[model samples]
Target: MSSSPRRPAVVRRAPGKLFVAGEYAVVDSGNPAILVAVDRYVTVTVSGSHTPGVVISSDLATHPVRRRWHEGRLTADGAQGGGRPRGGPVHVLSAVETVAGLLAERGLPVPELELSVVSTLHEDGRKFGLGSSGAVTVASVAAVAAYCGLELSRADVYRLALLATARIDPKGSGGDLAASTWGGWLLYSAPDRGFVLDLARERGIEAALRAPWPGFAVRPLPSPAGLSLQVGWTGNPASTASLVSDLHRRTWRGTASHRRFVATTTDVVHAVTGALESGDGPGLLHQIRRARLELARLDDEVGLGVFTDELRALCDAAEGAGGAAKPSGAGGGDCGIALLDAAAPQDISYVRQRWAAAGVLPLPVRVALEGIQQ
Candidate 1:
């Protein structure tokens, strides 16, 4: 039976993510990246709907939007000409539609759900670029699925969330989605999104979930035994999608340089994975530096604008303090992560001091061990 209107609300939360290694290169299918889920989160609450359609509200938006599926996609109530829903978050809506599609395939009626989202992934109304999009989507999928009497596995939730976000950005690596789904440190490889998208279009979301996704894989990695992850926020927020779009639009897009980038980045990611597995802290830091250099080379070759003055300062400060640091994701300006000797409290303090002097704010967030949580 569908969740009754008198049933209690269902709440799910998902953690934000940091890209430890691999950036632009992970966009291509089968390429690997390292991502760690952070303590910051996006929480989604689903309740019985009172409106004729689903009502959605988010701290990120100015007002709630009422929407109902049109054919299959969510459309705003009273929308003229069947326009797409307005003032509605695309990620949340995608999760809803994807899960709704799954329920339909199961011969179940779609329940009317009112969703409310609150996030700690931002500060002063600005984002930290800590995979807020991915976190929110994962949380939404879990919450809605649970409310509708479906209990999904971690992998199933991830597959649904991946399809939702991939619909928004086809070239995305989905590393953030993986991190948000599994939590902790992980080695992630991109699936052939083309293959999965085709499967979804032809068969359905349920079929896509059960199918073996080519080139997509994730394995957990232990946290370094002797390193501390320090995060520094550059007050400026960056649009990862925009930064990635720049790379894809470049004349260097399909060139030999891009291929070299993919090969070299894959090597760095492998080293990072091995270091974590062996708890080799220093080796992990060294490879992290190499990852930063690889990203710098990619930027030089493609003018991808992956770094800004603030992010450079963020990394330089950490390096000066004897730690290895780099922008967590596509850079531009967001957060940079540093790996410092866990035993060297002094060095960690010094890195924080230097970041402060350079106008970078230190964020106190740890790697979250859980991803989407009930």
Candidate 2:
């Protein structure tokens, strides 16, 4: 008699996040940010099937192919070897492959299974500044681990994510993934330097900050409801590699003007963080507007000035609706989120419709609290 094939189990959870303040500045000014995880998430689950291969699915893609362990590369199309290369699936496949390899090393025979992926975040090419990639990575890693009946800590997940990301994108600050895994506002600082020496330097600096950086209180932002509209857009999805390169070049030149701008932005980010927590709507609006104005000034120098008409209009409309607005991603176009309190629900609806008409996609997102869970 033939033995019954073993079935793998499924695992799932949501990824939460929020950018309370200090986003762009965090990269340059060494300012900290106060983040929160609302309720949104990316869900993933794995299960065994009688079939002889692995199957995966999501809105970003359809099933490609299931593959046996060591048979060959498993494409998403369910074909043995005729998979066409694509964006989203490529990453997904890589993640699965890594997990499969890990399992095999642990003496678990590879099993054919179906993998399902879903996300509440708009991966429609928008950077909400809420760590979408990190969140997705965590979710994917978690699913894989669950299927293998393995337990991995948030730190483990974060490390795994960094590895996976390196294989795919290869260049990104691990801050997003750190926040996604840790789930809170943070001042993510790498070693004060870039290596062994840097580590020692960072330790010394932390000892110094232990006495000065903690007595401060960050204010709260007023209720989001006070805003008449919240509009968001996806910018051009600029490469992080390029952004970091420019930062080094400019800073090395000791650009005084850029330094001053960064200082001012740090203050603004601090103010906004306080406002969001305090639920001070008017305060939030004022700070947001100021932040955007400053961003406008630094845009060209920082190579972030290429705003699209949709972004411009959204900013204008937010002000018209008695609120504030700003781009959500790396700028050149990823996504812009706006807030307006003076407008009624109908007004907000109208603004949303208008943006949609303009070919700008809008997403309804709130702060997420639960970071990642099984």
Candidate 3:
């Protein structure tokens, strides 16, 4: 009997995420964060490879990469020979290596493949900080799993993508991964880092990939009723890693102050969640204002400028229009979100005009109801 013909190309897409509330504090165990999966997406297409190795090309990359698995390692420029290419996309390599390792550990045959990635998560070479890396990893993993005839749930994709991202950078809280996996509004608490790391090392990658993630939870929540969300870009990109590193170096973690901060922020998150459930627009505004104050306090304590003048201006503009606003993620720059009292066209247009006057670019984004699509 002849072998079955190669499967056709697999295409997958995952949406980017926005941190509605709870940023730095979510790193603590069991702390809750509110995030939304945005409309922008990263799409990955995977097909059978004719060459001896995998070929990866992306719109974001200047060149394509050909890699092969040999002697328990991935070599660049195919299986035959060539030095590893430098300065390619880190997340792409991380995702491919991670899936390859997991397949090897499961005693499964590795197939030669080709991948093409396209994304709308960036504008004019500037990252929107919309969790592009996390989305790309999710899409890539989903595509590869399908290519290998492995069925993975959203949760499985999340766990695998989390591990893959951790291999690239262990500091991520996995909130982005969660949003990209499940989509929509979510209240997420990260899994225990120490436990996950130990598990990955003790058991083989297959076991780790298949293992149930402990202490992590992601639940969907309804969007606030009648509340309009808007995003404004500051035209300046902020480094989330740099902001996180600064917070860490300030000795902000594991201190009494940190505990107080978490408590205050958690209360805000709970208040927001409750408001969304109850459709309390005023309550939502109050909680967002409180959260912004709490973040400001944290910034003052750490001497890090989490809130820039532009962001503050945006917030002020929203408040002036009878809305509430705050910096979305790690702050310092990037984007800020405004929650309007109404979803009327006039209301949105007014806010947009004010945001423009404040020198912030209003981004056209909406809450994505769907997560990863294959």
lDDT of 3 by residue, 1-374 (tens): 01234688899999999898898888755788999999999999988877766678988778887666665555663354455543466677677777777777767776777899999988877888888989999999899888888788888888888888887666778898899999999999888766786787788666776677676889999988878889999888998878887887787778898889899999999889999888888999999988888899998888789898889988988888888999998998888998986656677788889889878999999999989997
Which should have the higher TM-score, number 1 or number 2? 1
lDDT of 3: 0.84
Instruction: Quote the positional error of residue 342 for candidate 3 in Å.
Output: 2.5
Q: What TM-score does candidate 2 reach?
A: 0.67
Candidate 1 Cα errors over 4 Å, as ranges: 1-4, 78-87
Query: lDDT of all the models against the reference?
Result: 0.88, 0.57, 0.84
Please give the lDDT score at residue 70 for candidate 1: 67
TM-score of each: 0.97, 0.67, 0.93
Residue 224 in candidate 3, Cα distance off native in Å: 0.8
Top candidate when judged by TM-score against the true structure: 1
Q: Give the Å error, residue 5, model 2.
A: 6.6
lDDT of 1 by residue, 66-184 (tens): 78756766787545474564456888988998898898899987777799999999997899989999999999999999988898999999999999988877888889889999999
